[model samples]
Target chain A: MERVPVLKIGDILLVSIQIDMEDQTALQLQEDLADRIVETGCHGVIIDISALDIVDSFVGRTLATIASISRVLDAETVVVGMRPAVAITLVELGLSLPGIRTALNVELGMALLARERDFEFKDIDDDEDDADEAVVAAS
Target chain B: MALSTDEVGRFAGLLESNGDALTTAWTDAVATLLRGRLSHAELHRQIAELQKGFQSALAGGAGDLEADAAGELRGLLSELSNTRARQGFSATETAVSIFALKEAMLTVLGQDGDINATTLRDYVSFSAFVDRAGLFTFDSYVRAREELISDQAEQLLELSTPVVKLWEGVVAVPLVGTLDSARAQVVMERLLQTLVDTGSPYAIIDITGVPAVDTQVAQHILKTVVAARLMGADCIISGIRPQIAQTIVALGIEFGDIATKASLADALRHVLRKADVNAGRRGAGRRES
Candidate 1:
C-alpha cells in the first residue's frame, strides 16, 4: 500500500494526501502519523486535502478518527484546503465531520494552530476571554 | 380551411395591383387600435414589410403558412411578434393588427364590384387563412414574452447573491427578499467559492432585508454555515430583527454553535477581532486594557 507522507514545519506536521487513500492505506497513515507526532513531539498536525475530489462517509469517518487520534496523542489536528464542492457534498450527506478543526488554507491552519497554542499558554488570558464573551453576548 | 392555389394567385394579383391602398387601410386600422404608440412612418414600413411577405408567399403558391414555400412568411411573422412583444404591446393588439389585414382585403375586393357567391366563398376561405395567421401571431407573442421573463429571472438570481469583501480575511453576503431554495443554493455556492477564492477566514451573512424567518430559510442558513465550516471558514449570521428573533425562538430552531449577530457592523467587528487574535495582529493590542 502507498503511504501518505508527513512533513514537519516548525512545531507543526503537514500531511498533504495526494493519492486515493484506500481503507488500508488510510489506516496505515493514521498509524504513521501517530508515530511521527510522538517522535517529533509536535503540537500541531495539518492535513491538506485540496486535491481530493470525493469525500464520502468513509472518508469522513476516517478524518474524524485521525483527529481523535491526534488529540489523544497531545496534538491539535487542523484539516486545511477543503474544496467548496467537497464541503457542500459532505454537508449534503449530513456528515459534519465532528472533532476536526478546519482552515481555509495551510497558512491559516498554521495561524489557527498558533492561536491554539497561545490559548494554552495563558498570556493574553483575561482580554481574550472578555472579547470572546462580548462577541457572544453583544450580538 | 386552406386557400386554393388559384385563390392564392388572386391574393398575389390583388396585392400587385392594389398593394398601396391595401397597406394604407391595414395601417390605419392597426394604428387606431395601437392608439399611436408607434410612429406613423415606422408603422407604415412594418405594414409594408408584412404585405410584401404575404405577396411573396402567395406568389409561391403557399396555401398554408406551414408549407415549405411560406418559410419567409413564417420568419417575418415571428420576428414582428417578437419585437412587438419586447416593445410592450399586448398580445391581443398584435393579433388584432394581423386580423386587420383581412378587413383591408375585404374593402379592396368590394371596390372591384364583382359581387358573386363564388367571390364571397373565396373571401371566406381567405378570412380563414388570415384568422390562422392571427392565432400564429398570438402564439409567437406569448413565446417571446415567456423568453424575456426567464432571462430576467436568471439575471436577478445572479445579481442578488453577491459575496463582497468585508475585511482582509472576511467576506459578507447581504441577502434580500424571500429566501427560496434556489436562491439559497446560489447564495451558498457563491459564499463558499468566495471563501476559497479570497481565502477569507470569516464570512458575515446579513439577512436584515429578509422579510421573514421561516423554518426553511433558517435551514438554508444553517446548511450554508455548516458547509462553509467544512471548508475551514467561519460564517457569522447577522441582521436578525426582533420579530424574527421571537419567531425563531417560537419555532424552537436550533442554530447550534453558529454565531449570530444583531447587525452587520457588529458581525464585522467580531470577525475582525477574531482574525486579529488568529494572525497575532495589533488589533489584539486593544485588549491590553
Candidate 2:
C-alpha cells in the first residue's frame, strides 16, 4: 500500500495528497495523522488535495472523517486546494462536507489555520458562526 | 428526376455551347426576384460557377445529381447556398435561382428547331432534374442558416459569462439576461475556476443588469455561492434592486449568511473591509468609516 506523507510546518501539520489514495491508504493516513497530532501537539492540520482530480464519495467521506478526527483531538482541520471540477462534483453528489474548512490553495489554507488559531486564542469554545466568518475572511 | 446517359451528354453539350447565354438568363431571372439585393457581378459569378459545375458533372457522365460524378456540382451548390445564407438571402430566393435555369434551358432548346416528341420528353426529364436541384439548394440554405444561428448562440454564451478580476484577491461577474440552467452551470464553473487560478478568496456576483429574480434564478445563484464556498472562496451577491429584493422576500428564498449588497461598489467595499480586517488592518478601515 502506498503511503501519504504528513509534514509538520511550525505549529501546523501539512498533508499534501499527491496520489490517488486507495481505501487502505486513506484509512492509514487518518490513523497516521491522528498519531502525529498527538505526538507533536500541533493545533492545526491542513489537508491539501490540489493534485486530486476525481473526488468520489469515498474520498469525500474520508476527508470529513479526517476533519472530525482532528477536531476531536483538539486540532483544527482545513481542506484546501479543492479543484472547481471536484467541488462541482461533490456538490452534485450532495456531499458538501460540512464542518470542514476549505481554502483555494495551501498558502491560503495556512492563513486560514493561522486565523483559526487566533480565534482559539480569543475564545476557548469557538462559536460555529464565528468560525465560518473567519473562513470567509481568511479565505 | 433521373437523366439517361445519352440525354445527359446532350444537355452537357447544350450548357457548354450556350454557357454565357445560360448564365445571363439565370442571373437576370434571379436578380429580378431578389430586387437587386445581390450585386450583379457576384450573382453572375455564382451562376457561372454553378454552370461550370453542372457541365463538368454531366460531362463526367452523371446520370443523376446523386451520382459520384456530380460531387463537384454538389460542392458548388453548397458553397452558393452557404454564402447566400450568410448574406441574408431568403431560402426561396436561393432555390429560385436553380429553378430559373429550367426557363433558360427551355428557351435555348426551342431556338434550335421545331420541337420533336423525343425532345419534349427530354425537356420534361430535364425540368424534373432542375426541381431536384432546387430542393437540394433549399436544403443547403436551411442547413447553413441553422449552423449560423447555433454559432451565434455559442458566441453569446461566451460573451455573457466573463469572470473578471475587480481588485487584488477579488473578482466579479456582472450578470445580465435571464439565468437558465445551462448558463447557471457555466457561470458557476467559471467563477470557481477563476477563484482557484487567481487565489482571489473573495468574489462578487453582480446582477445589476439582470431583469428579475425568479425562484429558479435564486436557486442557481445559491448553488454557485455554495460551490464557491466549497472551493474556499467567499462569493458576495451584489446588485439587488428594490423589486428583486421584494420578490426574494415574497418567494421566501433565503440567502442564509451569505453577504449581499445593494450595489457593486458596496460589495467591493464590504470585501475590502473584510479583507483588511482579516489582515490585521481592521482598526484603520473601521476608524475611517
Candidate 3:
C-alpha cells in the first residue's frame, strides 16, 4: 500500500498526501502519520493534503481521531491547505473534522501555534465541573 | 359380485352422497380429541412445563434449538440483573460521597479558622471524583457547603450588606464562591435572563460571598453589567470585601462607568430616588394639563 510522506521542519512536523483518497489506503496513511507524530516528539504538526481531490468518511474520521489523540499528548495539530472541492465533498458526506485545527496555509498555522503557546491558558474549569456533575447524575 | 346394473349405479350414487357426511364426522372426532389435549388450562400447564425444561436445559449447557432459546432468555435476565446491581451500587456510592463531603465540611468549620483554601480545594477534588463516579447526591451537598462558606465570607467582608428591591426586580441573585470562567459565563447569562424577564431598570448583585477577585471574574462581572445596561437595566455591585477591593486596586483592573455601591441599600436608594424624580416630573405635567 502506498503511504503519505511525513516532513519535519524544525519543531513542526508536516505530513503531506498527494493521492486522491478513494480506498482504505487513506485511513492507513492517517494512522501511520499519527504514529510518527507520537514517535517524533514534535511539538506541532501541519497536515497538508492539498493534492488530494476527494476526502471521504474514513479520511475525515482518521484526521479527527489524530487531532484528539495529539491533544492528549500535548502536541498541537493543524490541517493546512485543504482543497475547496475536497472540503465540500467531506461536508456533503456529513463528515466533520472536529478537534482538528485548520488553517489556509502552513505559515498561518505555525503562527497560530506560536501565539497559542504565548497566551495564558484559560482553564476549562466549567467543563470539568459539568462533566463531574454529569457523572454524578449518571451514578 | 353379480348385481343388477341399476342397483350398482344407485349404490354408487348413495356412497358419493354419504362421503361428505362421513368426512365431517371424522373431522369432528379429531377436533374433539385435540381440544381435550390442548384446552386453555392444559395449554397453560404445558407452556409452564416448557419454560422449566428450557431453564434446566440452559443450566445443563445443552446446545440444541431449545437450548439456544433458553440461553437467549438467560442472557436477557442476566443483563437486567446486572443493570439493577449497577444502579444499586451507584446509589450507595452517591450516599457515601454525600456523607463524606458533609463530614469534611464540618471538620473544616470546627477548626474555627479562616476557610483554608488548601483544605477546600482537596474537598472539591474529592467531591468531583465522587461525582465522576456517578454520585449525584454529593454534588448538591458540595455546592451547599460552598454556599455556606461563601455566605460567611460575605458577612465578614461587609456587615452593611442589605437586601434591596432595585426597581422591583423579580429575582435577586447573591453570588458566592470562586467565579471561574465557566461559572462567570453562567452568572452572566442568568443575570441577563432575569433582567429580560422582569423588565426591571436595575439589578442589585451582592457579591459579599466572593472570597477572591481574579482578572477573569472581574471581566465577567464587567461583561454582565455591560450586557444588562444594553438591555436597559443597571447592574449594581454591592458587598465588596476589603480583600477583593484591595485585589482589584492592586491589579489596576478598571470597571470604567459601571456603578459600584458599598451596599445593596445604597444601590436601592439610588434607583428609588430616580423613580421618584420621574414620578414627580409626570405629576407636574399632569397638573399643567
Candidate 4:
C-alpha cells in the first residue's frame, strides 16, 4: 500500500499515512514527506493517521522521528485523528510519542495552527509598533 | 529351551535361594575390575585406554558380550554425568532464588537478614508455594519482591494524608516523602480524581514531607496543576521547604500562573474566602429570583 499521501491545503500541507506501518516504504514515505515539508515552506504539517488500526512500536517510533524532523524544518507537525483502540494499544505497549502534539481531528489541528500563526504575527506587529514609537520619541 | 511346569518352579526356587550369593559374586567381579593395584600413572593410563577401547568398540557395534558390556558402561556413565550436571544447576538456581526471597522479605519488613515462622509463612503465601517442597521458583521470588515493595510504597503513600475538604469548593492534600516520578504521578492522579469527584474548584498541595525536590518532580507538579486547571480547578501549592525552594530557584523553574501560599492554613483560608464570595453572590441571585 502507499504508506504516505501528501496533500497541500491552502498554505498548510497534509500528510496522511496508513496502518500496520513497519516497512522500508514507511521510512521512505516519512523521508519524502519531511523533504517536501522543508521544500514547500508550508505553514504547518498535519499527520493524519485515521485509517490505522494498531500503532505498534515501529510505527510509533517512526511517527516520533517524523515529528522531530518536522520541528527542525520549522514546521509544526500535529498528529490528528487517532482511534481509541490505537491509543489504548500504544499505552498498553508503553509507547509514548513525547515532544509531539496530538489533536482529535484535522479541523482542530488546523485551527490550532492558525491561532499560533495569528499570535506570532500579533507579536511581530507589536514589536514593529514599539520600534516606530521609539523612533518617534528619539526624533 | 523347553521346561515342564515342575522344572520351571524348581528353577525359580533355586534362583531365589542363590540371589544373595549371585549378587556378592557380581560385586566381587566388578570390584576386581575397578581395583587399583598399580602405580597411579599406570592406572590412569589403563583407564584412558579402556575408555578409548570402549568408545571404538561401541562405534563398531555391539557384536559380542564384552563389547556390549563396555558400551553399556559408557552409556551409564554419560547418563549419570548429565543427571549430576542438571542436579547441580537446579541446586544453584534454588539457592539464588532463596537468597533473593530473603532479601525481598527483609526489604518488606524493613529489616536485615531476620527470618521467623510468620514471616516465612507470609513469604510463602505471598509467593504461593505449590507443594510441601518449600521451593519457590526464581520468577516467583522476583514477583513477590516487587509486590512487597509496591505494598510498602502504597502504605507510605496512604500514611501521608487523605484529601481534606476545607470548604464547599476547596480540598487540601498534604504530600510527603521524596517524590520520585512514580510517586509524583500517583499523587497527581489521586488529587485530580478527588477534585473531580468532589466537584471542587480549588486544591491545595502541601509539600511538607518532601525531603528533596528535583526538576522532574517539579515538572510533574507543574503538569498536574496544568491538567487540573484545564479541568476548571485552581491548584495552590504550600509548605515549600527552604531546601526545596532553594533547589527550585537554583534550577530556574518558572512557577508563572500557579498560586503559592506560605502554609496549608493560608491556602485553605484563601480558597474558603473565595468560595464565600461566590456563595454570597449566589445568595444575592437567589434573593433577586
Candidate 5:
C-alpha cells in the first residue's frame, strides 16, 4: 500500500500531495494525517495541492473529511495551491468543500493557519465561560 | 433538348472560334446588370477569365457540361460568388451575372443567321447548363454571407468581455450585451485565468454595460461568483441599476452571499477597503517591528 508522507515543520504538519491520488491513497492519507496530528500534537496542517491537476468528487470528499477530523482534533487545516482549472472543476462537480480553508500558496496558507489558531485559542476561552455558566445552572 | 455528339462538337468549335466576340458580349451584358457597382476594369478582367475557363471546361467534356463530373465550371462559379459576397453584392445580382452569359452566347450564335434545329438543340442544352451554374452561385453566396456574419459576431463577443487588473490584488470585468450561455462561459474562463495570473483575491464584475437582468442572466452571474469563490477569491457584482434590482427581486432570484454594488466606483471602494485591510495588517506588523 502506498502512503503519502506527512512532514512536521515546527507545530504544523505539511502534506504535499504530488500524485493523482487513488481513493485508497486518499482515505489512507486522511487516517494517517489524523494519527500524526494526535501523536505530534501539531496545531495546524497545510496540504499543498499545487501538483494535483485533477480532483474527482471522491478526492474532494476525502479532503473535506480530513479537514473536519483535523478540526475535531483541534488542528487547523488549510489546503493551499489549488489550480484555477481544478477549482472550477470542483465547483462544477458540486463539491465546494465547505469548511475547508484554502490559500493561493503555501506562504499565505501558513499565515492563515497561524491567524486562525490565535482565534481558536480565544474561542476556547469563551467556551470555558459558557461551560461554567451551564454548571451553575445545573447545580 | 440534349445535343447529339456531333452537335456537341460543333458547339465547342463555335465557342473557341468566337471566344473574343463572346467575351466582349458577356462583359457588356454583365456591366448593364451590375450597374457599375464594381470596378469596370476588374469586372472585365474577371469576365474574360471566366470565358476562357468555360471554353476549356466545355472542350474537355466535348460541350457536354453535365458530364464534367469534377465540377470544373462549378469551382469557378463558387469563387466568383464568394468574391461578390465579400464585396457586398446581393444574391440576385450574383445569380444574374451567371445568367447574363446566356444572352451573350445566344447573341453571338445569331450573328451568322437562320436558326436550324441542330443549332436550336445546342442552345437549349447550353441554357440549362447556365441555369445550373447560376443556382450554384446563389448557394455559395448564401453560405459565404452567413460565414461573414458569424465571424463578426465572434469578434464582437471577444471585444465586449475584457478583464482588467484594478489594484495589486483586485481585478474587474465590465460586461456588455446579453449574458447568453456561450458568452458567459467565455467571460468565466477569461476572468478565472486573469485571477490566477494576477493572484488577485478580489474580483469586481461590473454589469453596468449590460442591458437587462432576467432570471437566466442572474443565474450566469451566480455561477461566475461560485466559480470565483472556489478559487479562493471574493467576487463583488456591481451596476445594479434601479430597474434591474426591481426585476431581480420580482423574479425572486437570490444572489446568496455575493456582494452587489450599484456602480463601479462603489465596487472599487469596497474592494479597496478589503485589500487595504490585508495591507494595513502587514503595515502595522512592520511598525511594531
Candidate 6:
C-alpha cells in the first residue's frame, strides 16, 4: 500500500522515487501523477530516479507511460538523476523511453524546464507583437 | 606394475649419480628443439634442480611414480613449462626437456651392466612415467600461453576505448581497430562514465580509425547512442567514410534517429553550433539582467 509522494514546487511537480517500486505501486503512481498534474495544473514534472538501481521493462514502460500522460495534461516531463548502470540496462532492454526528456540531476532538470518556460513565454510575446503590428496596419 | 622399494632406490641412486650426464642430455635435446637459441647454462641449472628434486622425492615416497612422491616433480615441471612459455618456447620444445631426461636416465641404467627382465620392466615403467610427465608439461604450457594471450587482449581493449573531453560540455571517443562485442561494451561503459563525469551534453564518437562498418558494428553503435541518449546526452557518430556509408545502406541497417557526420571536423562543427546556442542563451540572459 506504499505510494510515491509527489511534491509541487510553484507550478512544477517533483517526484523523487527513493525506493524500489512494486508493479502495483508503479501503476498506482502513474494514476496519482496524472491526477496531480490536472489538479495542480503544473507546467513541468521532474521524476528523479537516481536512487533506482535496476529498471526492469515493467518499470521502464511505466515511466514512459507517465511521461506520455503528463504531455497530454499540458505538462512537460523531465526524467532526471538516472544512474549510468540503469541507463545501460534500459537501452539493453530496448526501452529507450523515446518521448521522455531527461537531465543529469534535479537542478539541471529545473533549469531545462525553466528554459522551456522562457521559450513558451517568448512565443506568446511574439504572437502578441505580431497582433499589435496587424492592428496598426489595419488602422 | 609397481616397482619394489629396492628398484625405486636403485633408480633414485642412478639419478643422483648421473645428474650431470642427465642434465647434459636434456640440454642437448632442448638445443635440438630450440635450435640452440636458449642459454645452455640456464638450461643446465634448471635440469640440475629438477633432477635433485625428483631423486629426493622418489627416495622418500612410495615406489610408484603416481604417488605423492611425484608432487615435487609436477611442481618442477609446471614451473619449467611456465618459464618456457614466457620465454617463447614451443610446447614440443618444453616436453622434450622431460622426455630427454628419461632417455638419458635409461642410458645410465643400461650402463650399470644389468640386463634382466625386472630392470627392463622398471625401465619401461620409467619411460611411461616420463611420457606422462612430458604430456603434463605440454598441457601446462598451453594453459599458460592461453592466459598470456587473454591478458594481452584485455590490455588492448582497455587501451583502445579512451574517452576524452574535447570541450567543457563535449566528450569524444576515438575508436580504432575492429568493433567486436567485447570492445563495444568497453566503449559504451567508458563513454557513458565519461559523459556522467564531465556532465557533457554532447558526445562525438569518432570512428575514423575503425577499419570497416558492418551490420553488427552498426548495431553496436546504435546501442551506444541510445544508451547515451537515455543518460540525457546526445551522441553524434562521426568518421563515416564513403565505403562505410555504402556498406550501411547495402546491409539495410538503420542507425535510427542518431546524427552521423562524414568526419570529426564536421561533427565538431555540429557540436559547436549547439554549444553556441547554449552560449547565446546565457549571453541573452545576462544582457536582460
Candidate 5 local lDDT, B1-289, one digit each (tens): 3445676567678889998898889889999989999878888898888776677766665344456632677777889999999999999999998899899989998999988997787788888877877887899999999999989879988898999999888899999888888888889888988887787878999998889989988887887788777666789999989999999999999998789999999999999987665554444434343
Worst 10 residues of 6 chain A by lDDT: A130-139
Interface RMSD of 3: 20.6
lDDT of 1 by residue, B132-164 (tens): 888998999999999999899789999888889
True-structure RMSD, every candidate: 6.9, 5.3, 31.0, 21.3, 6.9, 6.4
Clashing pairs for model 3 are: A139-B134, B154-B208
| Candidate 5, position B37, lDDT | 94
- List the global CA lDDT of all models: 0.88, 0.88, 0.54, 0.59, 0.82, 0.82
**Of 1 and 3, which scores higher on DockQ?**
1
| Candidate 6 chain B weakest ten by summed lDDT | B280-289
**Fnat of the models, one by one?**
0.75, 0.64, 0.00, 0.00, 0.30, 0.46
Cα lDDT of model 6 overall? 0.82
lDDT string for model 2 (B73-127, tens) is 9998888899989999889988998999998888788887889998898888888
- Prediction 1 global C-alpha lDDT: 0.88
Question: After best superposition, candidate 1 residue B240: deviation in angstroms?
Answer: 1.9
Give candidate 6's error at residue B3 in angstroms: 5.5
Alpha-carbon shift of residue B82 in model 1 (angstroms): 2.2
CAPRI grade, predicted model 1: acceptable
Deviation from native of the Cα of residue B158 in model 1, angstroms: 4.0
Residue pairs in clash, model 6:
none
The residue ranges of model 2 lying beyond 4 angstroms of the native Cα positions read A123-139, B110-117, B246-252, B281-289
For candidate 2, give the DockQ: 0.47
As for candidate 5, its interface RMSD to one decimal place is: 2.7
- Highest TM-score model number: 6
Worst 10-residue lDDT window for candidate 3 chain B reads B1-10
Docking quality category of candidate 4 according to DockQ thresholds: incorrect
